[model samples]
Target: MNLDTGSSDIWVPSVNCETPPLCKSINKYNATASSTHKQAAGSPTFNLGYAVGGLTGLRATEVVSLGGLTINDQIIGEALSEPTDSYNYPFDGTFGFGWSIISATDQNSTPLDNLYEQKQISKRLFCIKFTDQTQATQDAIPPGGELSIGGCDVEADYWRPLSVDGFWQIKMTKLEVGPATDGGNKLTLCENGCEALFDTGMGPIGGPPDEIELITKQIGAHFDKQSNYYIITPCDIASLPNVDFQFGEVTVTLTPKDYMLTVSPQICYTGFSKMNTKYQKADYLLGDPFLRKLTVIYDKDNKRLGFANLK
Candidate 1:
């Protein structure tokens, strides 16, 4: 399952589902096969739409186990219909770490909530450390990093209060280009404070079209019509300026190497993309590029997020 912090519902294809050819190839949930599974009263319809695809299912409760921590009576969706085009990936389903308020499953307590309430975890929080793909490949280390439950690392550099309850949304003060010493080239963005979502489900950094165009222009990024993405061919990685994201007093910086995904020796793709039309809930979606540089802590108990520079 994909650990998605962007959405607030757990959904897996059900054995009864026949449509979406891919669903039949992937793992499906069978309520009868699980001893802890319980169908919800009335079996309310569960419908969750995403940027790419959507799913329609029925609400159910089951014992969810994550890294040995068992969450009993966790609300889940038994998908009866799925999008084959969107679910072609290897993963069977998505395990949402988002808050319950955004959940489509009748606003029932989320799996994380159940973990805390059932004493499976001492604290209402979780931490994620994403490994840089570039570095991991060179160092021969694991690709994906660790997802620690219950508590956060003591070495966090900053903590910001969540702007809303739905997504892991926070306030961003400004976004700047260039180094800190030269005062940087501050973009006319987030001047009035912008809401940003730290989304694990997203791949690239997402923002408004105009703002992203401005950012790409500043970085000398050329849009590739074929790939529908921006690329910096013959990328002079060392010459690129640092991009800074200011959250009040705390400023997180992403170096050129951190934001560029190298496809080949001569080509590198900038990790900047426009937000999909379906999900315009935030000013920016800080995805894997931003995440690879810091350890993110989702503290639901205090309704805040913590960021620490990765070592």
Candidate 2:
């Protein structure tokens, strides 16, 4: 299952869905196979639409176990209909680590909430440590990371209070381009500060179209209409400057190695992209590129988030 902190709902395809070729490859949940499965007939239909994909399902309850933490009577979406083309990934389902206020079920049905309420976890917090593969070579292992539930890693050096109740949103005081020592140009786009979401579900760094266009222009990144990404020549990677995201007094920096996704030896794509306006409420989305540079801790107890350099 994919762990998404930006969303607040759990969904897995059901065996009853006979969407042929699509369902054939996906692992379906069998109610009869699980002794703890319970039907939620009176519950409303489960429907959730994301930036690219969506799912329509029925409500149900089951026992969920994660990293040895067991949660009973957890509400889940038994998917009846889903777009195979959009969800054709390695994961079979999605587990939300967000607060209940954003839950599609209109109830406090998130696994994180249940675990805390049931006393299964001592703390209402979790931490994520993404492997720093920014400077990886050809022989380097593919992207991988660790998610710590119930507790946070003591390695976090700084903590920032969340600005909103739903997503793990924070205020970005400034965005600077070039080297910090050289006094990089402080972009005026966020002069008054901007709302940014620390989204784990997103892969690249996303921002408003105007802001992204400016950043790409500053870095000499050209937008590729075909691939819908800002392309940068491999040779230019070495000459690229650092991009820094300032959250209050904390400044998270990303070098060219961190912001450029190397597709191959000859081609590379900028990790910064234009945010999808359909689902974008925040001015910026600090995705994997930002998270990989700094370990993040989601503190639900105090409604704040923490960050630190990896140990």
Candidate 3:
């Protein structure tokens, strides 16, 4: 299963008549085979909506193991119906890390919250170190990708307070292009500021349609109507200006190398996309393209997010 910081329920496919063939292709959780399995009363259905698709399932409780640690009576959803696009991923399901406020199950606490309550970990914190796409493209197994629960290794350079306690969201103060030192040439994109969600499940950085289109145009990219993305010639990548995201007092910069998604030797795509309306709470979603540049720390206890350069 993939670790999803945007949601709040642990889900896996179930072996049932409603289960799709794609779910079977991955792995299925057999509730009947587990001695610790406890069906929720009323067999209430669980419906989870995502940025693109959704999942429908039944709720259940069972023991879940993570390395040597074991969590008993962990609340989980047994997916009976999933979107076809969900099957394209390597993960069978998602292990949500968001707060219970965003949970589909209407539970009082999440698995991570339960672990903290059980005194399994000293700190209610998790760290994510994403692999650089450029490095990953060259090597089969990039060395730096990590998901550390309870604590992190590096000291944070800046800590951004969460605007909402639900989805690891932060208040973005500004968005601009070019270096901060280059005051005359800097182009302000989102001067009014907006809320941004830190989503590990998303691959590209996303914003409002108007803002994304403006950024693409400024970066010498053309809209590919068929692909529904902004494509640029590989030659323009080197000359493109850096984009900067300001979170309160801290500003993180992403150069063309960080925000350009290489499609082929001659073609590349901008990392920005139109914000999916399904995620209505935030105007922006910062994904791997931005995350790969920093060591992100999700501090549940403090209700804040910390960022530092990768070690």
Candidate 4:
């Protein structure tokens, strides 16, 4: 069992098989509660078939304990050949962490897919807020506080403070490109709570139409022949001013030179890009790049996120 601050899932490269596997954790029950359309209260979660390349079904709890959980217990994931065939995860297969019974949306708000607004940690999609051991992760989640199954305390803030602003999950208010000085459109900010979903595994920035269009214009980037993604010149502009994240009156300047987000080295020019299509109510997906800039605290209790900049 290994520990990855990235997506959650118990990947026992030894035997889980490549065809499919079972719920190594509690996400099963949680997902079952999502849309039990059936009157018998069928399990909301399911025995999702994942392609873990050449691995085995490693129990989630087993992995957590094996890794000597000190903080932010590790969640097992599936390993695949394509690297993006998450069937469920483009970042590979992840343990179900977002379920109606235990998500913020299930708590009262509506849930997307199976991620409900009920609890903080979803037993089904049990993913952790990964940070680069890259000097950004603050006091890790006390491994002793490892969560499993339906275990949770609404009043409990298992969330510890990170060195950075705990990856601020701010709302995308609006975006602008280029340097009002250089006259390039290069920005993607959020509204009140950045309704965008954060996925560390997927490509850097992807979202609905209007947003993607604005970013491409500012960064001097273009769409790939594939028409699904964009490409731009890679530069040492990590710390450039064109890339800005606005949270309230607080406008964050993501200097690639100082902080690297998106986790994709190919995106030479650092700027924002919107996902041309809306998957649901969610607009954007905060990729690894933006997350690496700060320590993201998934404080499920209060139903709000926290972040702190280590750089």
Candidate 5:
């Protein structure tokens, strides 16, 4: 399952008339079969909105286990209907790590929050390290990443204070593009500061359409209407400039190798895309592409975010 810091509620597809056939291909949580399962009072319905679309489902509680840890009567959503495109991913479901403030139900405590409340963990914190794919060869397995609950490594290189109290948001000071070398000619993409959300659940780095279009154009990429992506020649990947994001005192530089996605032998796509307007509170949504390079710590106690080079 994908750890989603952008949303609330743990959900999996269930056997129902509206359930997609693809749900059978992956793991399903049969609420009816679990002895500890109990329907939520009033059988309240829920609709979870996402970048792709939305998922409609019923709420319930059941025993949930992770590794050797177990939580009884954990709240979960049994998805009855979802977007057809949602099944394309390899994961079975999402384990929401966002704050209880973002939950759909009145009983807003997330599983993680409950774990802390139940004293299963000592700290209200978690850390994530995403596998960097740039080092992978064609058809070769990439190095796996790690996720740690309760606390994170204290050896992080930088720990920046979060600008906002929710959604792991930080204040972005600027964005620049240039060679990785010091004193290189850097082109400013976004000069004015804006809020950025660091989300482990999303794939690409997203922002306003105009900014995305400008950045793509600077990198010699063209928007492909059919694919809804910006395509560039694979050969040009090495020649493209590094994209730098300034988050207060810390600056993260993403090389072409980190921001380009190989679509085919000769074609690649930019990892930056336009975000949905409705969820535009943050000027940018920094996802896996950005997170993969760093060990990110979500410090709920401090209400801040910390980063260090992934070891």
Candidate 6:
């Protein structure tokens, strides 16, 4: 599971039987990794609906061998078991190839090859295609598909045809701050420079900043007496907001529905969770929320990401 990303932080889960901490636990895991000078990390405690029983990421060496890499510098621990629900993530575990570099023997080689030749992190991007047809939790995920980073193998993914986007990268135009509606007149979301991030480690695209700035601007422009995240369903305005996605060849238009995080009013900024200001550079990461939206084909061979809308 070698990926070409700037960050090399690995993730694992902390085992706190009762009243476990999610993000805090991951912080602790990072502390441990930093001390060893190893880029390893533990995920916060969580569950996959049933029992916490997925992830089970292989060590760096194991993946190299399996993926037919010439080098084996990576070190992966067996996926450990733990209770979920603390980290706000539904799945059990994640395998991060964030720092994985391609081996000479690897069939799919991206621009990262120049780096690997120079013994550096490849400047390539990758994405994972969640087999929604075979979607499952740690307890019930069907052994149907496999995930490919630098190349594709029927054995790696349970589904076939290998429909994928070449390299995982997109140009973000802007960010939309607020107003979530189902039809004609309401709120919206990240419109400008809102590039989608894709990663196995992240639970969802986390937003942390003066989120209220975005939310309030769009949301406040319309309804007056609603909470921060949710746009007031003004009876006066009988339509949904026009959700917009801007791509070169494809323009995705989704009617604004209730914010994904409809439950919390103030927490609308994150829609899931939040990151600090320093970490607020990237836009809607292609996290769980993202994978669920499309069938991402990662061509490590050519360093391209293929995108297909799933039915």
Per-model TM-score on C-alpha atoms: 0.88, 0.88, 0.89, 0.49, 0.90, 0.46
Each candidate structure's count of clashing pairs? 0, 0, 0, 87, 0, 52
Q: What's the CA error at residue 250 for candidate 4, in Å?
A: 3.2
Per-residue lDDT of 147-181 in model 3, one digit per residue for the tens?
A: 88888988788888898757799889998876333
Judge candidate 5 against the unseen true structure and give its global Cα lDDT, from 0 to 1. Answer: 0.77
How much lDDT does each candidate structure score? 0.81, 0.78, 0.79, 0.37, 0.77, 0.37
Compared with the true structure, model 6 gives a TM-score of 0.46
lDDT of 6: 0.37
Which has the higher lDDT value, candidate number 1 or candidate number 6? 1
Q: Sorted by TM-score, highest first, which candidate order results?
A: 5, 3, 1, 2, 4, 6
**Which candidate, 1 or 4, would have the higher lDDT against the true structure?**
1
The alpha-carbon deviation from the true structure for residue 265 of candidate 4, after best TM-score superposition, in angstroms, is 12
Error of 2 at 114 (Å): 0.4
Q: Tell me which residue pairs clash in candidate 2.
A: none
True-structure RMSD for candidate 1: 3.2
Candidate 1: stretches off by over 4 Å: 16-26, 87-90, 179-188, 276-280
* Evaluation by lDDT, superior candidate among 2 and 4: 2
Give all candidate RMSDs, comma-separated.
3.2, 3.3, 3.2, 10.7, 3.1, 10.9
Give the Cα-based TM-score of candidate 5 against the true structure: 0.90
lDDT of 5 by residue, 129-178 (tens): 87777555554756657888887765567777877655778788999877
Best by TM-score: 5
Give candidate 2's whole-model lDDT: 0.78
Residue pairs in clash, model 3? none
lDDT of 1 at 122: 92
